[model samples]
Target: MDAWATFWGWLFVLVLIVFAILSVAITIGGFFDVK
Candidate 1:
């Protein structure tokens, strides 16, 4: 049970990081007019 909880916690953090990166990338792309 402890291990499962830890796994979920890490997964959630990883997803958050990925989402942040994607949003930043999109913002920069729009600013630069990259196609």
Candidate 2:
């Protein structure tokens, strides 16, 4: 049970990191006028 909990915690943190990176990338792209 402990191992499973740790695995899920790590997975959640990884997903959060990925989401943050994606959001930052989108925001930066929005700043530039690319047509």
Candidate 3:
């Protein structure tokens, strides 16, 4: 159904957002961890 497809599309978008945020956080932390 159209509604089902829309729901899945939104879920995928949310997951992508979370993944991007995590990647940025890790990169910043690694930069400051110069030990």
Candidate 4:
């Protein structure tokens, strides 16, 4: 297997997970801020 490809795949997955968490967090924060 190619090391670069494997590395990039993991990086992409990690970034996606992080982005999802951040988006959910922001949505909750916004709801509280408006209350």
Identify the leading candidate in terms of lDDT: 4
Ranking by lDDT: 4, 1, 3, 2
Task: Give the higher-TM-score candidate: 3 or 4.
Answer: 4
The worst-scoring run of ten residues by lDDT in candidate 4 lies at 1-10
Q: Name every residue pair that clashes in candidate 2.
A: none
Residue-level error in angstroms, candidate 2, position 7: 0.4
* Model 1 per-residue lDDT tens digits across residues 2-31: 999999999999999999999999899988
Candidate 3, 1-35: lDDT as tens digits: 99999999999999999999999998999889964
lDDT of each: 0.96, 0.93, 0.95, 0.97
Ranking by TM-score: 4, 2, 3, 1
Q: State the weakest 10-residue window (summed lDDT) of model 1.
A: 26-35
| Superior by TM-score: candidate 2 or candidate 4 | 4
Native-to-model Cα distance after best TM-score fit, residue 1 in candidate 4, in Å: 7.2
Q: Number of clashing residue pairs in every model?
A: 0, 0, 0, 0
Task: Name the regions of candidate 3 deviating beyond 4 angstroms.
Answer: none
Model 2 regions lying over 4 Å from their true place: 33-35
Candidate 2: lDDT of 18?
100
Models, CA RMSD each: 2.2, 1.9, 1.4, 1.6
Give the range where candidate 3 is weakest over 10 consecutive residues by summed lDDT: 26-35
